[model samples]
Target: SHIIDVIECKTFEDLLATTQPLEEYLANAGCLRPLRRLEDKNLLVDDILMFQVLHRVRGPFERFRDGLRTLGVLDKIKGHPESFRPLLCWSPTMLTADLVDSLFTINLSPVGSNRRHAEEVGTQKLGTILAFATGANTVPPIGFFPQPSIEFLHQEQDTATPSKLPIANTCINCLKLPLHTSYRAFQENMDFALGNTHGFGMVKFLIVSHY
Candidate 1:
């Protein structure tokens, strides 16, 4: 099967640098010539790189968090890290309404779905993820669907330790705390979603297809 999409949550530049492996694979496999020839002839057959995140909840949030920490996301957030915007994130529960709307509108459909299944599932989360990751946002509102099937990690309170630099949210690529924003702001929101207990890495790529 052809590569439909690639959700490179490992920052845009990093992915570009890292795609050498994929490029090497294509070169070694002798597929690049045909693909490039087709491209030169205006015959597109693969995905257009779109920035987004896809999160899949498998066993538990803790498992996901640990996995992300291992993948260096936690470290990135702690320092002056560049962005590694993901196309989707899978969690056990749904996100807030505003965040959901920002990621995906309500009307978009799934990428591969039968009439019965589409009717039953509408725009399932996985379908939405695939659509956005593959640049399927042909209209004003992009993204597939929102599936809040799992439980959101409850917010935890941590002592206010003032910092000089801005704090970033790992899940949302561009989100950063304003310079003037106080640590209390973190307690109000960040501490809960992006605190020590619940890290952004907790919500990264996981092999899951929403139903």
Candidate 2:
């Protein structure tokens, strides 16, 4: 089920290009409120997704235009009151990186009970993937999630680390091993290593059979 949904969305465009809008997809996937919907909201979830996809994939100027087009407020303010016109006439040039950052960055830096709540809700996995895809990095609390202790694993294997998960914190479903490593050998090695540990919990063991 996880594989069918969140895991399949490898990129922002992958999500946006889907026939089902990402907001709807996420809403279906259990994030009831995908984006902060304010009372004065002019953009729908699809519009926001389109703007973000364009903003990231296109040039800055193109991104600005795309945002305006997606918002659809510009056209509606043709002959409105001066007060109403100012509300719609937002200059795309004034778009700050922080504003874009907020769009994708959920509560990544949660503390105490919030941190525990995130773990309970599987936010570590979901939030990590989303934040990484959208380039929103925030330090996670230490030992927030479990990780494998593989010596040969690359430090920069995934750009979304430093989430305070332990060493060798790769993707949620990945099990990293050296090239040409056999499945049996990897299994035997894990069995031996894990046998020594006291309480073994849920661990995904991935053995790459090919180099």
Candidate 3:
């Protein structure tokens, strides 16, 4: 059975803190190539649940340093000369603000895909977080993994009984409701909304900014 650590956070620190335990727990559990869900109850099959931190949780990144330090998660990857694999999860508001282009000032306009949006957000806050951490002469350059969506290994709502799966789109999982997902087309509505790529970007962008 796979386990999911679903953690909701209001700050970057909280987000980083939550991930540490998850990293340790999963690493100890021998979980390699963590899996994630795309949309609906669909997962990458055998992957760890990644309730990733998003843009909205920004402020005083120092809070995350300790958790990261204790876990050595960042340290372990410092010399690899790479960035965290990109993910399309949350989009920040600053980049998508109505006046961002002029009225609002933020690098990288927030548009299309949740993962890229979050990457931009992380970039701003990471500077502060890394500076506060330790043994810091310079920070590793982090880049976003450009893709359509974030990797989400959605856990089965119920592990006991099996349920019928829709042969195609247009069918909702009767067994799961509130948390269950439905598809508008062949693609699973990951964000569970009534829109396409544009819609997804708008919705996720709002979420990353505010929440």
Candidate 4:
């Protein structure tokens, strides 16, 4: 009933009031017993619910919660509740650019003399495009991208198809662009892959590949 009440809450204030008892319990018991109770009922607390909880009980809980969800461990945790600790107990670092950068492998042409220059330009452009979509300072949250440890490959020009567009593998977050071709074409294809909101009419397109 309390979980239902939390889900039905229309506003942050209402949710806060409803979760007050849980907060008190957390303070006294030193664990999130009320939240763990969801596991007994086979109910999963999602991002919105967790966000509301985080507002009152701040820490690295979101990171823990999201990591579990990303790893498909929510169901496992529900089955093995005793094996897991309360989200409040975790204090992992929030996602950062360095952390995200470590996940990606940028591959450029080995023989091309302008490989380094192309890499720099292409990487800068990608960052700029992401910033434009997310409105974040250069590096946005890892959630904005489709996945981690994405491979960036340079697309070479083929004589059969000289005007091929950039390809974005959203499933794996791999981006293949003509980084070895003309700068103008490369920029155009890059914009087409991640930007360029020409035919959407009224709806503003953020990340093109995402849509």
Candidate 5:
């Protein structure tokens, strides 16, 4: 039950100004003192701060975009293999299918998702995620997670226009839009394994193992 990493806020002043409830959560929880041991064992644990969670969810979108930001952040560190980042997100969730091809992103997909179960739009997205991750014609596994089955909301999520200052698109595919790079070609290659895979709150502390 050791957490592998955290993304700390930019500054104490900024965190305090934006997120008082989170400040209170950390202060009352005394999380750092109890987790010091786990922190010592995992090298990358020192790289991010656990407190960043507060600021990210302080306001609107009810932490939905914040959750996406967290997952996207996990995607960015796609090259780090020492540990994996487990996260909770609200909506418009993505699977790690595109990431596994990189030596780094493989660790991120402990459970895996697949568009094989989907039809139409969902299937297409999941397919894109899968093919991009595998780097081959071979279809990857797409099944339910053994424990904690996925619970997707029936309503389709509105694309919360990215927060101007905070959640700008980080997906390499997203960043390429300006260059007029053909994103459709990239889309055709991914596996959008849609399961209970992308959204889980309690899984955060389970991201890394002790031994």
Candidate 6:
């Protein structure tokens, strides 16, 4: 039967509603073979179950699982399951002052006006924005921001038009912002762009401003 059909079945519904062990039920129904295969590859079954139960099976999760199954890494993972634990059970690291300082590389020269703007708003304000956007202020998942470092750029040339919004180059995990009229406007724009879901997809390296 299809996985969706199995999930929507009366037996599955009864299993969910009852105090019966889900694992046992699945095992009895021969539904746990795939899960066992994943476990054999050292994948965290609990985490997968949690993700399916809470967020449903997302595209990324499906792709990841499919990749694992297709790659034939069962023997490799079986040999060193412990090595994968750190990755599976990763603890979220909160954004700190030192981390903020180390996270971004300012592309502008020290004497440049753009550099001064970056220095003024990039350090503290950018950190705040990143923290908020990535949920670094609270407990965030490991997938929140995969890349630790970001390239900060202030391309004044790109801002020839005053109406142009900031540009985020996701390919290189670079945040290139156009010159704004004021600090407040810059902050507001950053907040709006980073915080909004439709602004940029999956902010892997914090605020990814785009035109």
Q: What is the lDDT of residue 114 in candidate 6?
A: 75
**Cα displacement (Å) at residue 127, model 1:** 53
Measured by TM-score, how close is model 3 to the native structure? 0.14
- What is the lDDT ranking, best to worst? 4, 6, 2, 1, 3, 5
Ranking by TM-score: 6, 4, 2, 3, 5, 1
TM-score of each: 0.13, 0.16, 0.14, 0.23, 0.14, 0.24
Question: Could you report the Cα RMSD, in angstroms, for every candidate shown?
Answer: 27.4, 22.7, 28.6, 22.3, 26.0, 21.3
Which runs of model 2 end up more than 4 angstroms from their true locations?
Answer: 1-180, 199-211
lDDT of 3 by residue, 1-211 (tens): 2233323344545444545566665565444333232231123113343322332233345566556668676585554425443332354555554556578555565577786677685455444322222212244355222211212223467754322221111122111212334454323332222222232134335324432
Give the per-residue lDDT of model 4 (tens digit) for 56-96.
Answer: 45657677677888767977888877667665257577899
Local distance difference test scores for all models: 0.37, 0.41, 0.37, 0.52, 0.33, 0.51
lDDT of 1 at 22: 66
| Residue 201 in model 5: lDDT | 35
Off by over 4 Å in 3: 1-59, 81-83, 87-211
What's the distance in Å from true for residue 25, model 4? 85
What value of lDDT does candidate 5 attain over all alpha carbons? 0.33
Where model 4 places Cα greater than 4 Å from the true spot, the runs are 1-159, 197-211
lDDT of 3 at 118: 76
lDDT of 5 at 211: 10
Model 2, span 97-152: residue lDDT tens: 78787778464455567666766554344444323222223435553234322334
